[model samples]
Target: MNVLAFFTATVQTTRGLWRIGQTILGIIFRHPIAGTSIIPILSDGRIVLIRRRDDGLWALPGGMVDWGEDIPSTVRRELMEETGLELTKIRRLVGVYSSPDRDPRIHSICVVVEAEVEGKMEVQDALEVIEIQAFAPSSIPQEPMSHDHYRQLQDYLNGLTTLA
Candidate 1:
């Protein structure tokens, strides 16, 4: 078999086992609420990333959406709040992933969006982000992602096939 097929089969087998474990554990514990994350992109092709406050790891600048808020609005608001940039365009909706143990606090439905920045930004949320940087897609970190956001980044960079 080809490498892609082999990798996909392995992932499917692993995810199947993970789901079974989740079913057993969920009998006693409840999952956490859902959240959102945006992969902000500049017109020049640079992707926006932030240094997380809790850990000094880099990730996309996004957070949970408020109750009753729309996904696109959440992306726009998050981009503005975290990076101080207003998005000119919010791209199509990517796919959703729920691996049961992806998040430690709760089961989060991360709504990811690709967007283009309209202008410059100055990060306003001083507590959540330590620094903001724009890097080419090829320069992203390989491991130790801030909060599983890097998974979304990987999905996005890999033609967004799985996540889109």
Candidate 2:
């Protein structure tokens, strides 16, 4: 190989090895995270979804469980932060997803819930959410969603409480 080509290949190899090393270290040092994904159903029977600023794909409105906070509190906080809606009631537990590959950013167990919500629909967290919209069951977007949200929604729609 020419000198320039050999140098380019060496740098690429080093970068790839560095990423692999980081992944290994992270797995050894870190633990699985806990989070929530809410299926926010308005009184009118529409579900609320948010367009994430990170990937620009629509996702359920929920977030991680904070320190000293339980799942129910996380659900309420995330619901308001992402959708600007008040939680009238947590109607049911949809599922608990714990696959290591569920969230690309980290190994997270997501507790999905169906909640009755009220108030105006707005994007409260501009840093994380781009836009917020409510969709009827038949009107939800058909495109691929971020994370395992598609599966979560399907489990709820099918009336099956999942543990995965």
Candidate 3:
């Protein structure tokens, strides 16, 4: 194989193995973890999503919560870190997505939130985020996405006419 292709395959394999290792470690050492996923909806009724640098799927902007981090604060920090937008006010709890076999790295609970934001959004962290864009709730991308992001988007959209 070409050198570049070989390197890419090697790295992907390593990452795959690392995730499997993490899952096994979780079984031995950790409980179901909690994380946040933020849905940043713009004034025009469009929702924001991030193209992950590693996988290229347009997922909602968010990250894992720190040990003592409040969920709103976690959403704020993650939004700004990934999209350069500050969370103004959390609109509502969009939904909670937790399945027994959702992620390979851990048995995790994802607390999804819908929120308003300030400032223009962009992909700020080059290592983790690749692009940021807004889409009408009806037209979230069809490409591969990170876990239940699409479902979260659907939940947010379905709730737009009422309280979530």
How many clashes does each candidate structure show, in the order listed?
A: 3, 1, 0
Better of 2 and 3 by TM-score: 2
What residue pairs are clashing in model 3?
A: none
Candidate 2 lDDT tens digits, 1-164: 99987876776576446545555655888977778999999998999999999899999999777669899898999998788899999999999999999888878788999999999998766767999999999888876999999999988989999999
lDDT of 1 at 127: 59
* lDDT values for all models: 0.73, 0.87, 0.77
Give one digit per residue, the lDDT tens place, for model 3 in 1-164: 99987876776577456545655666888777777899897878788889987767889998767657789888988898789988879988877777866555578788888898878987666667878999887788974688777777777777742222
User: What are the per-residue Cα lDDT tens digits for candidate 1 across 22-48?
Assistant: 545544577544567778888889988
TM-score of predicted model 1? 0.75
Candidate 2 lDDT for residue 135: 93
- Mark the 10 consecutive residues where model 1 has the least summed lDDT: 19-28
Q: Give the winner by TM-score: 1 or 2.
A: 2
Which regions in candidate 2 have their CA more than 4 angstroms from the true location?
A: 1-28
Residue 57 lDDT (model 2): 92
